[model samples]
Target: MKYSETINSLIRKGLNEVNHSINGHLPLSIRREILQTINEPCVIGKISISCALKVYPIWNDFFKNDTEIIGLIKQSEKFLLGQINEKELLGNAEHLEVFVQDYNKEDNIMVMFAGMTDVHAAYDVLTSGGMEECVSDEEALQNPDTWDTAFIASLAYNGGAVALDAINHDRNKEFWNWYLTDCIRIAFFNDKLPYPPTTSIVSAKYFSGNNIKEYRTQPNIWKENAECRSRMNDIKGILVKIMDITHWTKSDFYFYHVGTASYTQVFYYKGNELVKFNLDINISMYLSRKVEN
Candidate 1:
């Protein structure tokens, strides 16, 4: 009847539904492990049981559509649970070849951004001279539609001064300036922007030296910087590092980074324990954006 009780009831219901859905498919031990994970009170990465339940229908649709992959996942889960040996798991994996091909055919930006593998693919395409082929610096400066223009605009619209500070404070000031300038130059030659305008738009004046100074003098930027600093400092027992892309999926730490950024941070727990932190690029950008206002 009470609000807290209602939330607890919902969580229980969601966990029951998930357990029932996977029942008789995966090994009992595997199911139990998954249920334990789903029932955790705190967040995993950014995913919570409440959020997972709310999005169940969408994920269910995918499960139904890819029964083969689901089967493989079940087998994989069994292997992970020690119900099956590695040899047995590899035997089951052979059948995945056909399914893997079909799955690749359905790939798009949304899919690419969802998992670790796809994240790497997206990053590679964006950084491997593909971005340069799309827009030029001169064109980006002149046209609002250019990727360069939109990237700068997006930073400004999203809080460029804050973001600049995040990068400078968390990383280094020199890297921040280089990144900003490089993005501006690349936007000019870019034929298409990778992300939608709503996510990447920013003002042109922020790129100008005099305008940047005036913009930084605003009181709001300082306020935001203070708030962000407090939040970062509050994350005790977690160490953030900017490292190469290979570190994204490391088992020892929770990884977060924007593909556009040169490096990603691996956040390690105090005692080298594993935590199910979700890899969220948006959150990474937001936290990092809090640099010296």
Candidate 2:
């Protein structure tokens, strides 16, 4: 595609903004995000404005990253040019954006996680308001061995107590909460959400008759079926935020099954409509358990 003076200006502005944001120690993934956002409008087509109008969540969430700013400019370029193709101009939409791959060519992706802890003491003592049980005793015993960062973050914190402990450990609970805020994601640009009708199974049977014809029947299993859902989402113009933490253990070998607090959101143009989507998911992280050897 031909570049206009305006496009060039936008690109320059984007590069500068991104460079500063990275503080000159930019990683390749971030750099790609900046490039994709700045060039999206020029390459795709008004996706930016449309998304701003319909997907405020995405706009609000990703505004923290340089990619969002560049994406707006790129969308402006596409809108002005009127060069959208059939696939590009679907749904009478505005923005058509794509995600940035890493310098290593690894696609940008985020994972979910869950975490836990173990104690020689009873669960009550560990959770109760007894310093001797949960704090001092464990500390004096040098039993940092049982604290599972991911596990404690997921399950124990469900009741707010673990949250308290988390705050005490880092003393930066406020920062961590803000860090893991929810955001929506878009799968692709110029894509439309496909809505399908629900289905029902009127009758299901397991071969349980005693006759030779029905001989040796096994129980038939059934599961709740869900229709597939799809929509257009652009990853290029959005910022994905993820949280990372490494827990400490006292024993050389302690085991933990935990989840990490990380996620992603995207902005998209489906024809003329804009959309935002999010996923609050979980995954497991494992560490060897500490045992008296």
Candidate 3:
């Protein structure tokens, strides 16, 4: 598809924005607009699914016969389409959470990156949230679900880029810089959400008893949509804010886990002291911010 001059300009701007920054986001006004339009929790879940599919090849091959991840992805999409209730979806998410916790992928960077994408997809249960934030350039909204969702989306979309960075750790090349320019990911333009790809992963052999297409959760989207929109708009009107602390620990091995503050940690000796570091969605951050105002 041909990009309009405006979109081409925006893409170029996005490229430059990520060129030197550790983390960046669309402007606050634009982000707010996106949050406004996405009142349906399923919409946010769709965002997560599309991002997760970005590294589908890596995920598909790395796990071989273990189709639990694909099953989870399929379940998630089905849930968004009203094929499953929240209780059932939560059960599936818990099962995937346990699977991710048991799998060990930290030994290989490629597996680790792709594995993280799966982990993030499971977390995209889409009981979504967006906080009403204070007026400050330092913030990109601090709601727990939204902040964590942002991180989840990043890992899903950038798993390949991160794997490339690992491969070229010694060569000092930035694959992320080129990854964005090489292809125009359709998800960035149009969305086929709530529909996981009808790939080989969903063959009857893989889908089997897990299929729930015939039993929609039967939500009344027409009535719920109005309520959700009003509620989300109220969240936007909030002035609550958040603050968090970055922390580190010491360990001699690698560890990875999913759900809640899911994290990946690798230890390296800093002059004889092995240290591990990670970011967390500390509730204290939000509590402190809310208390302060």
Model 1 misplacement above 4 A? 1-60, 63-66, 105-293
Better of 1 and 3 by TM-score: 3
Worst lDDT 10-window in candidate 1: 43-52
- Candidate 3 lDDT (Cα, whole model)? 0.43
| lDDT tens digits, residue span 1-293, model 2 | 34345444544554454344312211223223333443443222222222222222222222233343233333333434544433333222222122211211211011000101111111211122112223432343244344322222222212112222211222122212211221011212233321111221110011112210111111112122121111111111112222112121111111112232222233334445444433333211210111100
| Segments in model 2 whose C-alpha atoms lie over 4 Å from true places | 23-42, 45-293
**lDDT per residue, candidate 3, 143-204, as tens digits?**
32333333333433333222221222211113333323432333344445433344444322
**lDDT: which is higher, 1 or 3?**
3
Each model's lDDT comes to 0.31, 0.24, 0.43
What are the runs in model 3 whose C-alpha is more than 4 Å off?
A: 1-15, 20-40, 108-113, 129-293
Residues 92-124 of candidate 1 have per-residue lDDT tens digits of 555444333344322221121112121122222
Candidate 3 TM-score, C-alpha based: 0.44
The alpha-carbon root-mean-square deviation between model 3 and the true structure, to one decimal in Å, is: 17.8
